[model samples]
Target: MCNSVVLGVDIGTSSTKAVALTLDGQILGIATRTHQVDRSHPGRVSMDGEIWWQEFVGLCTELSPHAPGGFAAIGASGMGPTLMLCDAAGRGVAPAALYGVDTRAVEQIRQLEDAFGAEEIYRTGDSYLSTQSVGPKFAWFRQHDPEAYAAARTFHMPASLLVHRLTGAYVLDHQAAGQCSPLYDAARHRWIAERCELVAPGITFPRLAWAGDRAGEVTRTAAAQVPGLRAGAPVTVGTIDAWAEAHSVGATEVGDLMLMYGTTMCLVATQDHRVRHPSMWGSPGLVPGRWTLAGGMGTSGAITAWVRDLLGGSSYDSLTCDAAASGPGARGLLMLPYFDGERTPILDPSARGTICGLTVRHTRGDLFRATLESVGYAVRHHLETFHEAGIVPRRAIAVGGGVRSALSAQLVSDITGLPQQLTRISIGASYGDAHLAAGLLADTPPLSDWNPVVRVIEPRPEPAYDELYRLYRQLYESTRDIQHALAARHSASAGEPLPDHRATATAPERSVTAPERSAPVSPAGPDTPRSPR
Candidate 1:
């Protein structure tokens, strides 16, 4: 039992996290270290890949001693769509450019539209520049920083870079490559050179491998920082965080959706065929033969976190209580939750959040409730899109910080009317990576003996939530233009002669808005239709 531990590292957008688990999926210890996501200027977000690796090593050491023995396998996962550039030595020359929200690539979107009709691109590829991708970011770097592009020897995503640093091997996982979008043709299982050249001609990222496939072994170099991490630990290839989150919940069947309620809400569902919904996200996630229909909302738990800070800077209990005080529909006050830019439905990074229908009659509870409901509204939109694509979610498992609250889970259920399940660890994405890795190791122990969920959160659909959702759907159409005007004002303020990456996409005409004003509401109760605990 002492020799049965495994190591899992989850590289998030803003931090690197590590966890120690036994082969049966039980976590023994956990550790984390935040890495800065540099957004010094608008339209640009960057980070050093080395920063992630070093922090990961630190966190692994921090978590390892508790396990008492060395790990059986090493697993890793990371924030999606963070493209890293490297020299021949695998050192990051410039910082990594981040995902869809980074507007530096909007110009690249136009170039793509011009080179190949937008219709053709979307129909064939099932994706666009609306965030969650690295192609646009790559195009922006090549066009604006040709000097850096010329000097770059190889391209990588964060996971590939982690694998290389761990074992001095530069290779990619196929699931991690989904965001390469047009660069990879899912149907053909090969890179599409013509599609890549439509934007960045010379860029060739690492070759792809399946998640859980062994890339290389750890070495003495990695062991220096990661205490007790065996140099010969079987190193499994990595995956994206959300994919790992999906595995954490045991959401492995077709029609099962995994809803990750974290800083932003992410939904990934396994489906029989490729799903191309213009308003939703679809990608090639872990299961190679099966396709994944993904849906992301710009705001979920983040807006609630914002409200928590604003309202007397109190605890989540106070915030949830505030939300509970207000009845469903947030007393007619609704928020879009697009504060950072949106993904699903609109796919407009230029879009923003909004608070609508505020009145003197409204209290803190009403406002708080609306923010919570906004997540449900966005999730329902995602669900509807999947239904259209013929992928109805039989059940959804909740994984993330939001699952801590019973009310938040209920709101999702009441709004969507689907049963939800929570996990014991819900420990972000890395554990899932380790879980899969251990299951695939040559001398691996059975996962069932190691990891087991502590509890499950079941959605208790409330009738009042349905009425609130109705109004939530209509508020955006009513204030769409107003949101656009705000973005225009934002863009106009940018002084001329900024770095290419500093420029953002033109604000869309207010055809929509999410949370325009900060609001609050009760931690609504979880919906009924309970499952076995």
Candidate 2:
């Protein structure tokens, strides 16, 4: 069999995508499987952890035909840093708690902050404790479900889970480790033992590696499940989906920013040194020594989806056309795209979506356009935060499904007053995964050769957007109290108590139940296995 092709797969909030690509970045085949997250409880977002592996196997099987010659190496990425508990056999013990979208850890966040001084935590973690943090989520898991906590032998995010199943190497990338906050010390690039014990006692965290580092070879067992992958195929260490998406479009340079338009709108700016702020996330970059400053909106395409479904399931193409005709300012309508709370910049979980200046004259187009523009405003807010932190990204590369909408992509450029480069291949993280996999081989081609910039969307700023942007910021400040009240009311009716940090003190540290082990075995060595043809 030919050994020139590699495979990459990504598990996302709404779908799983697998792509097979030649070493030179020619996409041989792409397969996608759609799924939804569980939002059964208020302020919580989760998904059946088992479904991730299930879809991976299915997608690999379907895409195998295109890779006639077995895949030489494989790479994976996914939506994270999710909290998924696993047993000794690597099976998920419960539904995985998703990232910032899951706001069940507010109380835990306060408890941890009080226990460990907030400033100290931020100083070490390079990020502040928020819904985006995994430490608080671990605390919430231990507090809310002690049984599962005790039963869990290890914890994993989606990508790491796939790696464990594929190569029997339990590992987490440095980029993902930084997102654990408090639990990880970004400066040292290691887990904080005291913080880990306090939040998730006895949990065996995965060994840390960089995103493209080789974790191990695909095991014979994994080979049986995934077609086109031989038992000894190399597999790169996995990372979060957004970072992978950034790499896909060559946005990993120090002065580059990747704006992802997907279930959420994420902005990741590459930096040479650590850059931390109260309103943004600073984490280890895909490779060691490099760092990243990032921000995310809780909703983007999700809002558009909600609008489309609300308008009797109108097609996105039709809705986008209508929104384009609605013009800038969305016909005097303004929106706060905080449908599932927000992340980065204003870290407000209780924030709710609001559309002001709505009248009977407003049509579906107006509503859709306002929804799209709201995300643009949110992107602008993130850019402002970057400026506040003294980071001015020299280049902005756009990727993801939302970028497929000409109107949506254009609105973001116009509102943010930034030109966005579009990549030739837009398969998102899966393509990035394949690129990472290709890097494991010698004589790898440069990113420009794989996926060059195809077009540019330049800003067409308008006076109307400038005015609306000011009101957009003011609208949130003016309605914050009301939004909090509504969120509290909804939680109360749902029989969920919003934790009151005022009355609570520090959370007590817990003891470890599992026996301590020696240092983790590094995945690299001269004897490391290679793919067999």
Candidate 3:
């Protein structure tokens, strides 16, 4: 029984991962299943919710052999406040609308802000309405797809979706529920019933629980589908992947910030009291009586992937090498990392990517280096915002697939002038899920013993970054109007007009990718396998 393992699975934006680990945090086995999201239309990113379940089963089946005595418990997390509206039978009616990356709810955000009054909404929700909020997406669905909306009975984010599939328990963590801005009252820690009727009428909201609380036992149906998972094993109510990743690295202490470099870059600052700002999001922490101030950039590694794909398909290692050779200022090139528009602080879906000071003298390496620096500047911007909100992080711990790049982490530290602590087991949110699941056991060790800081990335004094940071801030303001106009032109060219009373269109076609494969296991260090959410 002491050797029995806990299973942790996470459904993310680009992939789903599962890990089997013991109570003291020795990772025995890990698996990853990579997939892509649908971007057939502009400002829209989605995936079939059923794909999440399929990947969950595949990952669990692959990792089952590592746990010989059968799994003791299960925990899950995912990229969220996503919206996956379901029918009476718990099947997704349409592709799940992803988080802030899907900006189709811009107009709906404005409408909700006006209807509820920005200040009142902030007072209740503890965060301003933006592309990240779940309410506007609900309103968008209500207005565009009336038939699907009428048929929808319940909704789930990635974590809750997995919980429901495994345990037959429809529940969401309070941290996730709070991000459903304007639909959740943060002070009261309950769903705003009137707001629910206003945005998603007749849709039943899931019951709320803490991230570590036991939701239910795995059902016989799920046990048969997932190899080695016992029918009566308990499962924890997991929260969003970012928060789970935070917990993985012991970032829940007051004044500790978890900096996640993944599909998108996110910063979560844990606090004892709530911190509210129009630009940042505030949510309940993983446990009761704790709070978090969170914000993210809409693009990070996504930009890196775009650059890599565009400049011939070279591996990440070769690209990093070329980027490092290009040196500190990127040969006078600068970039705005807003290819998918911006989030947090700016919150402008109309924003567009910009590369300034480009000339024939510049090479692909310079462009890639500029892209990395752009993310650093964005991180500095968010840190400044956190400082203004009176929540200064005493320590910043870096985790995720992006942390696999030493150049990326070092550049961020140099630009922000803050040291970043890298943890021992950076297998990401799945590892954190295991930690949550282990809490159900009486003899579970502390998180510090489970995972500890292995290295610290100290900041170097870079004179070029100070000047570049000034220009980076100015570039956005100077080009705001032009970017908005071009964004409108791009939308018009895409020609997927929003549905109205005159005509309603069917959902976009689902994309099929190669079969999921397991990432080879590596030693515990900077190179550990992590699929960025």
RMSD each, Å: 9.9, 6.6, 9.8
Q: Which residue ranges in model 3 land beyond 4 Å of their true spot?
A: 497-533
Give per-residue CA lDDT, model 3, range 1-533, as digits (tens). Answer: 67879998888888899899888788899999999999888889888999998898888788888886678999999999999999756789988999988889877877887788867887777787878889999998888788888778889899998899889988888899889988887876777777787777778778777899999999999888878778899999999999998998899988899999999999999887766766778888998777888999999999999999998888989989999999998999999999988888787777889999999999988999999999999999999888877877899999999999999999999999999999898889999999899887656776778888899999999998999999999999899878877887888899854312001010001121111122321111111111111
TM-score of each: 0.87, 0.93, 0.92
Q: Give the range where candidate 3 is weakest over 10 consecutive residues by summed lDDT.
A: 501-510
Clashing pairs in 3: none
| lDDT, residue 80, candidate 1 | 72
Q: Look at candidate 2 and tell me the lDDT of residue 345.
A: 74
The lDDT, on a scale of 0 to 1, for candidate 2 is: 0.85
* Candidates in descending TM-score order: 2, 3, 1
- Model 1, residue 153: displacement in angstroms? 2.2
Over 31-124, each residue of candidate 1 has an lDDT whose tens digit, in order, gives 8887667766655667777887788767766777765656767888887767777776788778888655565666676666667765565555
When sorted by lDDT, best at the front, the candidate numbers are: 2, 3, 1
Query: Which candidate comes out best when scored by TM-score?
Result: 2
